[model samples]
Target: MKKFLVLGVLFILPIVAYLFFASGVNNFAKLPVLTPAISDVTNFKSLSEENVSLEGKITVLSIYGDNVEGREGNAFNLNEKIYDKNYNFKDFQLVVIAQDGQQEQVKSLLNELSSTIDIKKWKFVFGSKEEIIKFYKSLDTNLKLDKHLSTSHAFIIDKNKSLRGRQENNNEEVRYGYDTSSVADLTNAMVDDVKVILAEYRLALKKYNKKEGLK
Candidate 1:
């Protein structure tokens, strides 16, 4: 009777272990801890004069110059998608970096966009052109900035200020392309990337709370 009971216990233990892993709980708990050394370079203030940081938010960053005025096709479209999908604006934000003198024009443009959607989560940050250029290079992106600060690319800055974007093993560009020709695909991919980043943050929060309770 004792041998039979021991055999039954061993069989049940393996099955329980398999089920636990199959449920994906194990994978979720083991999510990699992102520790990028990059610090937030957003020294500019928003239209409302609030300093920005990535301590508790995911950011989509773009540098807008004089050329950014009438040629913001991709930026405007991306904004609409983000606004429509992100019901909780606190979790996601869009940061538009412009030169110090461009604030009034940028604000006016943003106000026009606000007519269609809530622009509360949209932040227009202003700094010197030289200062902003240095900040843009720090992201390590591949997009070439022409006279207009025009580039088909934007970047994802995670809560930890670590840059997050898809990069093929041998691809030159670290970020997902923003070509207007493939606008649909690019937009969907970007939005999906943002969702994944947010999910990672939520999982990290849960793990932190669990550890705190144990202590």
Candidate 2:
């Protein structure tokens, strides 16, 4: 009887420990929302003249400013590291905000990217300089756009139009955006965070469906 009891304890202990750690991992998988209810981009028109909205979508947002040509390297880096991996997610999008007159330059860039990539989920929206500044301000982040109205950094915006990123990184700094120029930042940090946010939504959806089924 004593031998049987010891065997049962040993078998059950491992299972319990596994379950406990698995729960912790799932809880940690959720990405934190830094800013809530960010402004939508529906007021602006895409390169195709269609209105774009941040609602109901997981967006990687960037401002390319007026020099779409100058930032060609940044665009390519983002395409390779980020969009190429997650573009197939139905609600995922890459929206670049550019000044209104840069449509031709944007078209040229798109033409080059399209030759080698699907480019369908990638969108470029145009707005007046004033409108662009106003929209950027609505994000309420600590970062600033450069003099050219561009930044090499890209941000994650969730389905609720909230800004998402690490509140404190390894350097003990608040990280609101990923540097598009750095492959390491995209590969090491942005990729994982994007997965987390997508998983967070997937779990919520699963719960919702299960509740509906129970009803």
Candidate 3:
């Protein structure tokens, strides 16, 4: 009777552990989509004159405003904390939208960053002030761009052109964007959220491939 009891305990332990981890994965499968199908950036012209698009890409979108030169610190903070860690992911990109005339300043900043990091996936796009404002408004978030047409906040835009972020829960305020200037915010919140979105896509892809395999 004691041998049978021990065998039953051993058999149940593995099942319990599997169920626990599976529940955790399911809970984090999708990051909350705060705004659905926001504007795409295909209309803007990249610094290289290449066409840039937010569709079918996981974009870290930012507005450098008219004061591109003044936001150098913010750029470096994001580069070190966020871009460097995730740039290797195939569909991941960092897109900065700056006023049309700030091309030189944006180029200079990218040149400096290129010395130590791969800037290939980091794209800077140009647009008129009115166009930039129009695009920013499309996000439909409470966050505002300053008079200089800039904000320290950077947003995550998924492949479907939707704004993804944390919802208000446990008395916490809704977070539409991460503060680029705050390393703690990027490290603790932004990085983890990025991982969740990436994992979500990977799981979807696996399911798609499996379905095709059966066919």
Candidate 4:
């Protein structure tokens, strides 16, 4: 009886330990860095007279055309999906950029959007189409205002101003999802990337601030 009990304990212990350690490793695996730091743009302003920057917050940016049908509505859908899941993170911001002269329309769209989510975290900005395209280029995206700007897409910019797309830093397949697979897939994948950034940032802070007694 004693010999049989020992064999059972040994088999159970190794299986339990392997599962525990495997789970931890999976959680700590590194996700892609996405992109280099985003470049700055000038001549754009957020709603309510606030200046905009990519510093110190995670920014999700989408470019919209005022005259394009359903542009603002498409952006609103993506915003609602992300906000509904991750609204607890105060540093997460959604920035919608429109072509110049569309401020009133953008404002109206925002007014409607405010009824559903925290519109305070949503910023509507516009500049000349030329400058807006220039701003898009600064982020290293493939968008061209003349042809390829799609309101259905959103770019995740990290707190350090880096665009989070396709910068694979690990063997793990945890890269940003840039495909238009479906609205549900797109929103959920983007939110997962956001959580990855937050997790990495917190881990970095803990490791680097240990000696400083930082929180």
Candidate 5:
């Protein structure tokens, strides 16, 4: 009787252990999400003035070719796509990381965003490396940055303000007959990259806000 009872206990224990472990085999992924690191945004005037860090707003940062005003027209159009056309502006944000010396250009861009009719709840940030690294350090270390990651390509940051995608730069500049295009035709493609980030941001916002009881 004793031997038979021991065998039964051993058989059931292994089965239960196997089932429990198998059910959560993929849970390690949850640990990688970590938390936001926006505290490092040092160069902005508003961080002290507004007493804010855009802690709750999603950010779309343009790390590219010109100052904010240089790209204001393009940004205005995108605003319509997100706010009016798509109605996805509840948590969307916009930032432009222009060249370090271009404050005047950035200010013009901000004015453009502010003047737009539907510019509600959106935040526009344009600043230096100190202010921007917070956006970068917030991302997964494995995520790649575009080699052309200057002040030209737009980077989409999640509500947590973690950068997810941006314009990629291919160092290889080639000539299509006489056009002289630097980077491959497939390198640093911005639109597709931003879309991928937006999808993930949508998922994160849904989960985070739901947990926080936000609508």
Candidate 6:
């Protein structure tokens, strides 16, 4: 009886340990990660033109929702106002995320932006109302949504495809908390951030190039 009991204990211990480790591994595998392929989307072009992948290029995602301005079209655009030599982040991609109710307003804003700015550098996309809500929940971002996206309280995504920063066009110096007046400044900030990131990517890429050459 003693010998039989020892064998049972040994068998149960191994099985228990294996099951414990397997459970941990399964949990780790379920963790979510943002990848380039999932992050990649069709570029927003007003006409048939060249669309390039700005993977390594820094990008900003302009989201639109109920929190927009004047019920106008909400657009995600590249910040092109900065012109400092040190600030050379060039490849900027802007994805517009908006709800359906604001679709017309978003399109209108895009049209207006095109006329006033060379939005050729932007990639705007409008999301369903449900999708807009999901994005915030999934990202766990802290953005005060005013139910309209045409305003300055928009989110910005970084090149690594991770959301990096956000700023509302809340400059008392600028009239209208959210309007065309803030577009230039908002977009400019996006551009400036891209340049800073691009510079770093380029530097890392350079090191990689040299290392690969040696190999």
Task: Give per-model TM-scores.
Answer: 0.74, 0.87, 0.89, 0.73, 0.44, 0.51
Candidate 1, TM-score vs. the true structure? 0.74
Q: Could you say which candidate leads in lDDT?
A: 3
Taking the tens digit of each residue's C-alpha lDDT, what string does model 2 give over 109-174?
Answer: 999999988999999998888988999998888889988888899999999999999888678588
lDDT of each: 0.66, 0.89, 0.91, 0.66, 0.45, 0.47
Q: Cα deviation in Å at residue 112, candidate 4?
A: 1.5
Per candidate, the number of residue pairs that clash is: 0, 0, 0, 0, 8, 17
- Please tell me which predicted candidate would have the highest TM-score against the true structure: 3
lDDT per residue as tens, model 5, 1-215: 99989998998999999767644433321212233453434345431134334456555544433334445545655554433333354655554444455666655555666675555444434456544555555543433334333432344445564444322238532211110021231133433344444555565666798989954
Residue 172 of model 5: what lDDT? 36
- Between candidates 3 and 6, the one scoring higher on lDDT is 3
Q: Which ten residues in a row have the lowest lDDT in candidate 2?
A: 21-30
lDDT agreement of model 6 with the native: 0.47
lDDT score of residue 20 within candidate 1: 79
Q: What is the model-wide C-alpha lDDT for candidate 4?
A: 0.66
lDDT of 1: 0.66
Count of backbone collisions within predicted model 5: 8
- So what's the TM-score on candidate 4? 0.73
Residue 172 CA error for candidate 4 (Å)? 13
Q: For residues 25-135, write the lDDT of model 4, one tens digit per residue.
A: 447644555567766533686667788777888777777755534575566566666756665676877777777677777777777777877677777776776777667
lDDT tens digits, residue span 55-122, model 3: 99999998998988988888899899889989998999999999989999998999999998999999
TM-score of 5: 0.44
